[model samples]
Target chain A: MLATAAAAIALIFLQQAPAEDIDWDAEFGVEERERDPATGEFPVDPYEKSNANAGAEPFANGRLAAAFGGREGIRRIAERTVELSEADPRIAEIFVAHDTVRLKRTLSEQFCYLLGAGCDYTGRDMRATHDGLGIRTADLNALVENLQQAMREAGVPFAAQNRLLSKLAPMSGDVVER
Target chain B: MRTPCVATGLMLAILSAQPAHADDLEWFEGGKLVLTNGVTTIEGTSGGGIATWATIAGLEMDNGVGVSGHATIIELPDYGWQSHGVAVGIANRVELSYARQNFDTRDVGTALGLGEGYVLNQDIFAAKLRLLGDVVYGDPLLPQVSLGVEYKRSLDGDVAAAVGAARAEGLDYTLSATKLFLSRSVLVNATARLTEANQNGLLGFGSAAGAGHSLQFEGSLGYQLSRRAVIGAEVRTKPDNLGLGEDDWFDLFAAYAVTDNITVTAAYVDLGSIATFEDQRGAFLSAQVAF
Candidate 1:
């Protein structure tokens, strides 16, 4: 009986010893404590870099509503050119008188540029074109109205349109007559 | 074990067949609530040839079942105001409606000896079917076309018929096409109707068959100012059924979506009424709620 009791006690002790006598330091790993440069404080935060922050939180591209003047906006502008020319007799006459291919191509380029659409514009200057055609302000205004109406019909909301038209308005002085 | 496997497979096949049968009915697998606001002229024949800009609320669901309610009100100077008795959409394809209109003839009261108190009211029952148009998804340019008919009866049948009647009651039928240009944020509508009804809802004039097969043409342009707001203008040619006038009028309308379930539409209407009658230039407002 005495031997059996000793044997049981030894078994319990062995099981308990394995768990309780763990090397905690080895498990956690050794980390060096560094002093702050200014205060010379020990145990400085490992993540601390500097206080300055600029710009915005970084985000992956194409994850948000795309920036304005993208390919879609530019394509709309190009399509508008065709629609505008077709709807107004005056604009049609201009196309008939001028080089149709060049005019169509150049107008497309100009629309992309005005929309800030991600496309290159290779066309004649606006002032030169207007001077060549003697495009009056009234005619230009009519074209603008036609464009606005078509865009409205296409369901391009007014706010986005207004933003794009504002950039194109400055060129009106050069294209239109006083 | 073999028998159990076959039974399970049979049950699955039966369940799948049910949905396949339903798919043939509608383009969208899940039914959706589609909102359509078209002018209320009550199918092509009626005594009162005039119509108001009315809105229709529609509920369409998976089994191709649809329901809708239409309402409109127009206030006239010589004639009193009128309102739709309302209608129900039976399926995603058919709609039935009733409307009542009262023309006060307030200014012409002394002339008719009705003490400027003459009011003409008629009840109209109408039904419409979705013919070829589709309320498309993922598509920005599909028209919603519907063909409809309306039967109208003047409460004072005797008085209405005496004014040179063709059909003691009236019948009107029309075809409407509506499209929303998503990229441009505008809605365009075109409608043509054949009818003989005089003032559309007024009972005084009879059908126009005696006069001619009067053709009515209408066009509308609407702009979506915001996600829930639309402003638009409409031009409609109406028949002069009352002998009181010749050419009808045009109107400009504005509508706001108060919530997903309700919409409020207001318009400035100008209907050239009877000879020297008050220019039907007045305001119209209607609120619609849908489930």
Candidate 2:
């Protein structure tokens, strides 16, 4: 036992001697990320952007956009939806680890583009954005309710709200991972 | 014999190799939107007050189990009706339900040589399977559709037979389609049923001669007045097998979601005639809770 203690002390010293030469973070595959100063969002790997990334076709006319209170209203609804989902008990856990700031901006852009409120969507594709989140059908529905609440609060007509829903409803195949 | 033995060994090995995976399964997660599960019908299934829709019975979503219950009352000029039931929804896909219904014959029973205030009772058990589409998702034009089966047993066997009914038990098969066009704030449901029931099996099944299956139709249209309120109307056509002048049924109804889990419905119903009594029109009221 005494010899074993001496050997253990020697092993510790030997391990510490090489610490300065070890690229610990790289060895562990940890990639350091910096938040963009202007956007307060960490950079993601580059991906091609297209309107198709929004996962739905935009409205042909401004009628639907007008009903949603134009670009400002769409932005408000998207931000409010993100806020509500983050606070909701049924789905708060899924949003906790994600950068909500980026989510708000992308969601706002997606909504504005889909509603034809005169904005280009620069967010990641729906499937790529939600990949690996293990989101289930129930989680998708929970987010849908949060969006509905936001739209209702914005005083959008029920029919007009449904019009937007019709566009996004089919994207469940991409958003739901479970 | 060698092949059979090898297959059996393989099956046993596969079964024994399986791991306990209960932790991966989710249960009882209630996240369906308000009133999306629909109200319980008279037969205990999810639907409008008088007709069953393609929607399931509980507030559970695609990965949860949900349960719901309801109590209903209806007043006619010559009779009283009451029913209570419970239902279970599985993964928002399948539903099982049971209901107990009572038909009160205030003075009509005495007139028919039975005691005053005699009541007829029946028990109904039903199961529904959603086949395709969704009420609130996917293609807006493709409505939710389902198939269902209902089994009814009457408590008054002797009375039912005496009243020219072929039997005291029967079955009903139904196919339904429903859609909620949220943009229009309108919801529509249509159902086709094959049945042998008389007065919904409260009186009994079939003709006295034992010949009785018929096709029927139920249609409902609803308009959303608010997030939690809807006004609708329904019409159901029944076979006049008993020749008791049982005319088609119609009702105008309004439903309100009092909370995320409770709903109340009231309607004015017209039954046309029953047991030789004409103009059996009155009021209907129902309350339900789900989670």
Second chain TM-score, each model: 0.76, 0.91
**In model 1, which regions exceed 4 Å deviation?**
A1-178, B1-57, B61-71, B135-142, B204-209, B275-278
**A-chain TM-score in candidate 1?**
0.52
Q: Report the lDDT tens digits of candidate 1 across residue range A1-178.
A: 5676799999988874447777777778966555546644343224322111110121223211133334564455556666677667745765554544445545555555444443345554555556666554335545655666656665555765544444454455456542
lDDT of each: 0.54, 0.89
Model 2 chain A worst lDDT run, 10 consecutive residues: A13-22
Over B231-273, each residue of candidate 2 has an lDDT whose tens digit, in order, gives 9999999987778888889999999999988999999999889
TM-score of chain B of 2: 0.91
What would the per-residue lDDT of candidate 1 be over residues B1-291, giving only the tens digit for each residue?
A: 678679978999998799658434432221232234333332221111134222232443323333333356667665556565554444445666666666666757678655656666677777777675443221234466777677777776655665544554666677777665544556677778776666663543344346634678777787767645777887778676656564566777777757645666788878776544657687766655444
Q: Per-residue lDDT for A63-131 in model 2, tens only? A: 799999998999999999999999999889989889898999999999999888888899989889998
